[model samples]
Target: MNENQQSMPPETPQTAAAPEAAAAVSVVALPWYRRPLFWGILLFLGLLLLAGWLFWKEWQQAEATKASVAAQTEQWREHNAALESFMQQLRALLAKDPCEVKQGLGRITSPAGVMWPPLASGADRSDAVPQKPGDLADKSGSGRSDTPPAPAQNNADAQKQIPPVPVQKQTPRNVSELMEQATVLVLAMKEEGLAMGTGFFVAPGYVVTNAHVVGDATEAVVVNKAMGRPFAATVRLVAHDNGQDFALLGVDGTSGIVPLKLAQSVSRTERVSAWGFPGAVTNDDPKFAALLKGDEAAAPEVVYTEGVVSVILERNPPLIVHTATVSQGNSGGPLINEKGDVVGINTFIKLDDASYRQSSLAIVCSSLAAFLRGAGVSITMAQASESAGGKQ
Candidate 1:
């Protein structure tokens, strides 16, 4: 065994180092960038960074979306709140009894005028003649009277002898007079609120106003200065076409008031007057609210604005543009000539935001007549009359 061990020879440092050096050479041969194991670790780190960036971008987008949604929700909430408040107020107004409201109003009295003699209470005595006792007996005996019964006075002779008892005129002589008799205050109770507009007597018991004024309401209140009372009215007709915008109201106890006559044609540059209860005139007035609530003693007077026809639009339903100073409550009011005849119905006003200019518009009489005829309403039109100052 000693001899075998001697022949094998003891292990040298170089031989041991030889295996280690071979392993070092293998490690040096493959660089970090070329080694699969090294690259695997680097790829893992790169993927982790990319994932982190994507997550951050998604989180940022979510935050922005959340902010936008919040803003929209707030706006809707405010809008709904305002709508609810309006509905509540409207309900409160509708709860009150209309009759009680009218009773609360101040009394309107008739105008001062000369009193007439009371009529005799009995049957017709106009034909019966007073005779002396002797004359009646003479007539029964001889069928003839000694005085030869005073010759009967004819109607014309009697009328002359009476010196023509003063009588009130039925027809209005001018626009000022027509306003007192024909123009009316229209109060329409709608879902929105109390819509106030101007109307006039187109017939004995019929009033003409704007369809927008009436809205969907089936009834309205008509106030006449001469009548001195509020009359309940029913919607007779409403023009379906938005362009027409006409509505008719029928009121009872409106008889004896002379209806306004409508003109057949109108020309540009003609003088015209608009009659209505414009809100601009009374909106700020304290008494106006009281008047509407029936607390004021007297009704508001009609306003008249004078202007000339600016232009006539040849639309389907012809439009008359005028320079008349009309406002919100002037809708449905009459546009009249100097002779107190209606030529158009004031509808709306065009406003220019940049220039602050206004153009008042009306539906010509021809359109009104056509609407009335379509509804089978009888409207008395004026005969061919002279223009304001010159011939037509």
Candidate 2:
């Protein structure tokens, strides 16, 4: 039995080695593509490569977009620079005075008659002789003066004695005539931009307009049909109080233009007319468009609108509310009575907050008179009776 067991053991060691080798062979026989460990490693490496490719592609796209945006930004910056340069040139062109240009061309002609003459020199005047009250009284011992009072001058004799006024030749026959001859277009250059409004002759070489029209400008141009050219004007006075809205301009040569008379009072419901170069009317006219576009030869016609005085507002710096149709360019125009006397200055329009109804507003003549008097402007005041008689 001991010998048989030793032979079996010897066989057993070799057999055990064969079985272990068979198991190893079975594992090696499996294909590498089918093996779980090999496939797992392959899948992980493929996923990493895919992620890297995606990241690189995204980075390249971002760079391209960034470059495009930079190029667009530079393009816009250049466009803005060009626009700024154009605006500067336009402003410089507008600043050139038309009156100065016309004067250089020798187009301005002086009127033959002088409207306002300079005061006589003191040396040219004779001293007045002082006389006592008693000297003219009872020199002949009579209570009444021996020299009978000169016969009361008749209208005919008065007419014959008085010399013909130079302005009489340019006197308008009616209201329509007066407005055409007196109203002027006021143009000025202000910090805000170009400003336009209406003005009228108050005296020889003197024009009245709204203070807002002149703004802070010291110079302006006044265009009138009678003058046939724009006259250079300087701002003489601007009311400090904004409520007054009055300005006086001293024109270079406006002596030939007829002056309008100022009424002392305005009556409610009275027939009135507003005269100006209203934008609503003038803007549509091609001639006026040419005038605005630097055509010095073009003349804008005056616009006349008829209405009635609605009411007189009793507020500080009293205002006149009228039905006369006034618009943007009507500021500083004259609001005249039927008798051709200026009752107010068209200033603005009030709009109702709810209904949006428009109400034309004007500066009362009384306030205008005060403003003129304070500024020492010589204006002709008309009587109520004269205004009534002159009404058509």
Candidate 3:
């Protein structure tokens, strides 16, 4: 029995050692890197690190590309804005005409003297009935023959002596209609800026304005208030009388404006209006681009002031004084009566003070008539001869 117990104890010790042998065998079976779970975890950690690095690089590259595109877009916008501004300046330069500017007036002078007539009320205010366009039947009828007349030397001579009447005489229109038709804007460039003034059609292709308004320019430009392209003009005739402060200018082309009829006389109580480009409304030198900023600018316009004749002066050539408001640019405008007849040329203003208190003066019809006659312009006023007789 003692031997059997000893043998069983030995078997118990072997059983305990067997578990340690198995553990050692398992540890020695694979190295740390060769184990299946160890290798799988290492590979997964490596892949995660690689993916994080790639994502960070892609994010940095995208940020750089976005910054470069933004810089290029801003530069292109600046270049486009600069190109548009240059085009506007080029268009304004091309619109100016070469013949619009002139150098001198060359050998033009005023008449010896003008007549200063006493005030007279001879202007006819009767409404002018419209005349039809046709040849008037000859009251004499002496040249008529039943048979056809042969072309002869005597007939040609007789026909030359007697001139045929035109189809239509001047059709007189209302003063309001004439104002819209005849008024013109005169512009002349000087050292300071453009000298703007008022003028009107006196004949088909002729205009009358002030001497100072025209200055010594040989060419002037006329723009109608009725909205048309400016007409380039040559100063065909210029008559200046310092005493009268008047000038007669003949434009190159007919403005197609209705001419106002000249009145032989103007009464002291006549209601009148002075039409012109007053300095109050017109700028001597306007800066359009700067003044308007980015907004579009429009063309300048004229102004009119209404008043009445207060007194007629007793000077050498009588001046018609009025209460019509006048300004620096109103020098060459016409003093038109209620009937729309041109009585005088607006010349100068006498200021009571530096304030708005002022009295305006215009050259009377007698002086204007004398000036027109000296220039060989024949006017058909019913009482022009009688008005001249009063001046003497």
RMSD (CA, Å), each prediction: 26.7, 24.5, 19.0
Q: Per-residue lDDT for 19-52 in model 3, tens only?
A: 8898887864667877899989988999999999
For residues 1-392, write the lDDT of model 2, one tens digit per residue. Answer: 78777776444677669978888878847777888999899999999999999999999999999999999898878766765654344333323332232122222222323111111112321121102111111122232323454433553365357522322237677778889889988877654435678999888888999887777778877776665655667899988464678889987546777889999788778888999988778767676555443444566899999899888889767888899899767889999988889999998775554565678889888888888888898899998785653233
After aligning candidate 3 to the native by TM-score, how far in Å is the CA of 57 from where it should be? 46
Deviation (Å) of 258 in candidate 1: 1.0
Candidate 2 vs candidate 3: the TM-score winner is 2
Off by over 4 Å in 1: 1-173, 285-287, 295-297, 387-392
TM-score of model number 2: 0.56
Score each candidate by Cα lDDT. Answer: 0.69, 0.70, 0.57
Candidate 1: tens digits of C-alpha lDDT, residues 269-339? 88898998887785555544544434323356788899998889998788898998998788899998877
Give the Å error, residue 14, model 1.
99
**On a 0 to 100 scale, what is the lDDT of residue 63 in model 3?**
97
Top candidate, metric lDDT? 2
What is the TM-score of each predicted model, taking all chains together? 0.55, 0.56, 0.49
In candidate 1, residue 359 scores what lDDT? Answer: 80
Clashing pairs in 3: none
Native-structure RMSD, model 1: 26.7
